[model samples]
Target: MGMDNKMIVSSSPHIRSIESIQSVMTDVLIALFPVALMAVLLFGYQALITMVISVATAMLVEALWLRKRDIYNDGSAAVTGLLFAMVLPPSPPWWLVVVGSAAAIIIGKQVFGGIGYNIFNPALVGRAVVLVSWGGYMAGNIWSPPQPFAFGADVAAVTGATALADQGEAIQYKLSDFFIGNVPGCLGETSALALLIGGIWLYYRGHIDWRIPGGYIGTVFIMGAVFGGGFYDNHLMTGLFHVLAGGVMLGALYMATDMVTTPVTPAGRLIFGIGCGLITMLIRLWGVLPEGVTYAILLMNAVTPIIDNFTVPKQFGGVNKSA
Candidate 1:
């Protein structure tokens, strides 16, 4: 028989696609453009500086780790860097951005053998590290209020608290401000409108699934509505406020929907999302922290393998061995 006619066997991932890692990461960057643009528009020059430092530091660290001159290797480092920036305050000290970004690429990703092998989201890991190591810089009532259209303004001089915080002064902002991202918060998480636009773009590109995001956002809304105590106008509005404010929009639409560091089975994905939302609300409403997206998602990431194992579909036409 000719070589063309012979059958050849391969490993488990026999399926193939036209998409490459570079192409996928490129799409993710494109989707993130609206968020980054909104961040710059909302927080001005300092936001731009923070992002540049983060992306640059992440790429530099990854390049040095691989001993390659090409810093943009597969674009994963860039993505991880940008995501890390999104979670940070608009005007954190430059050293903080550099340390967190480097730690993200090194400890969060490279230590796990790189790229597809990482069990936790690198960006969240970086955020968690900084939050724990330097709580003064990462948390509290130090958030800079957004100076929309003031590209040259010094936003860091005007500090405030986020809506999610327990401070009574933080509750003054309207829901409209939260939706349009005029309120004070993290660099990329303030604008629910921009995040929704990016989420739509990602969904269009088939980079995410509805099960995770839908379940996440839905559970958050339901829990907030039932238990939120009608502080923001009404229970429904409080639920809406919870969904619009903080990092829920960014986390539900981007982080929790990560292709890696999440479950593969359909049921497992939904369960993972719900678990994240539940833990997030538990922390936000009762725990010491005001925001919980980072730790919530990280906790769920730790149990992904178990979720998949329990939810995996049985092979078709297979009989039970016990029988």
Candidate 2:
């Protein structure tokens, strides 16, 4: 008999993407540079320190969990950790951050069978867990930029102020300050310009599905404008402030674009994004929380699988009731 040697290998789509998981993750990190640099510039060294601590903690937790679980050759943990660090407020204490990172790596990722298998965005789940468990600590937004170089020693001793200190009672910033990230908030969330630059890069690279961000931002604008009244400059300004602040840009560009946690089809993704936008606006206008992007994303993440099921590509010559 002729020597028989055949091998069978199967993978997704049968068509290869020029992108590897590591490369995609790397590109994401690169795209974030502009925003990260801007955040550091506006918020100071402490912001950079926060990012480093969060990312480091995330990486350590992810690696340890993977080692414990016996599946040890994926780069996803690094991505999750980096993304988590990018969204956290600068004032988060080290211990709370460590807890969040561990939650992201362990319960959010490895426990779900790693990487692509997770049902939710690991970073968001981790952040959410911290938010629920340590509401007071996590809500501390007292962050300040490095004192000017001339101020020297004072820089080390400065305490950060709260982002929402003047809200309701009085609006302390112009719409412009909020848009430029001059007003206090999460370190990374201050600059709409920087986030937009990063978003444009990701869109150019085709790494992101623009529908999600577009729909999300657009829906928020329309809804916020309607409730707050009209899309004229003043109303639009308020909407812009809301859109550019907090984790809106970060979530739209990074977390909301999570391939595994978001709907696969274009329409489904559009619907998911619109829902996020609507919920964010509703919560911001009337809910207890001042910002709602993270919670909105997580709430929608729960519905993504259902969206995918309904939006799956139609079988050839089959009924398309899902339409």
Models 1 onward score TM values of: 0.93, 0.84
Q: Candidate 1, residues 117-233: lDDT per residue as tens digits?
A: 889999999998899888888775888889999989889888888888853754798889999999888999999999989899989999888888998999999988998887888
Cα lDDT for residue 143, model 1?
Answer: 88
How many steric clashes between backbone atoms does each model show? 0, 3
Model 2, residue 159: C-alpha shift (Å): 5.7
Residue pairs in candidate 1 whose N, alpha carbon or C atoms collide under 3 angstroms: none
Question: What C-alpha lDDT does candidate 2 achieve relative to the native structure?
Answer: 0.71
Error of 1 at 204 (Å): 0.8
What TM-score does model 1 achieve against the real structure? 0.93
Full-model lDDT for every candidate: 0.90, 0.71
Report the error of model 2 at residue 212, Å: 0.7
Best by TM-score: 1
